[model samples]
Target: MNTKIDFSHLGDRVVYVKPVAVADLPQEVQAQAEGLDELFAVHNADGVQLALVADRRMAFLLARQHDMSPMTVH
Candidate 1:
């Protein structure tokens, strides 16, 4: 039942990925979300949000597309 994760020591070769609920999005984002209830987010080494993606694969792909290395935390 524990779903928490510790990413404080995550390596530089990886981009942190997490899920975000549609309701938590900003008004502009929520309005453009259409019917999606959730989205995945990609973050860089400094914990900066890089992209909001529709799925996990897209997150990984985005990192690669941006020339950054992606490592799976799980």
Candidate 2:
């Protein structure tokens, strides 16, 4: 049985980012995040904000971030 459901039609707010470990990320995202980690030192700031790509569209803006890369993970 295919458990995958198409939620694309839902409003943009439907997809939300919950707190999860970097290891728990989907393999593809985990890999990409790993690579990004090597190149960027993710940081947290009170006012700094960045736009992240989501579902072929710029869907979300995040604040108070931290590094998820291997170098920073430790």
Candidate 3:
């Protein structure tokens, strides 16, 4: 599948969504981006792919389906 989303530098962290393509992403990021299709298609809602960074590295990607109330991170 092809997507138009891109990444941008958000101060200290890199944000992916606006100007990056899935094919251009790093291996780890490609995996995260690929999962969005399933998340969006199954839930039929806006999903959030939160990428957490530390020491200039991607620590994790948190996928959350849209809900009435915001989700809590722990």
lDDT tens string, model 1, 1-74? 98997655644656877888989999999887888998888887788888898888898888888776766544
The candidate maximizing TM-score is 1
Candidate 1 local Cα displacement, residue 71, angstroms: 4.0
Model 2 earns a TM-score of 0.24
Clashes of 2: 0
Residues 1-74 of candidate 2 have per-residue lDDT tens digits of 97996655542323332233545555776676644422222222221223333321222232222221111123
In model 2, the Cα lDDT at residue 54 comes to: 30
Ranking by lDDT: 1, 2, 3
Q: Which whole-number lDDT from 0 to 100 does residue 43 have in model 1?
A: 83
Off by over 4 Å in 3: 1-18, 35-74
User: What is candidate 3's local distance difference test score?
Assistant: 0.33
- RMSD to the hidden true structure, all candidates: 4.9, 14.3, 14.4
Considering lDDT, which of the candidate structures 2 and 3 is the better prediction for this target? 2
Among residues 3 or more apart in sequence or in different chains, the pairs in candidate 3 whose N, CA or C atoms overlap within 3 Å are 5-20, 6-19, 6-20
lDDT of each: 0.79, 0.33, 0.33
Q: What is the full ranking by TM-score, best candidate first? A: 1, 2, 3
- What is the per-residue lDDT of model 3 for residues 1-74, given as tens digits with 9 covering 90 to 100? 88874432222232232223455556786677645421211111243454332211222232222222222222
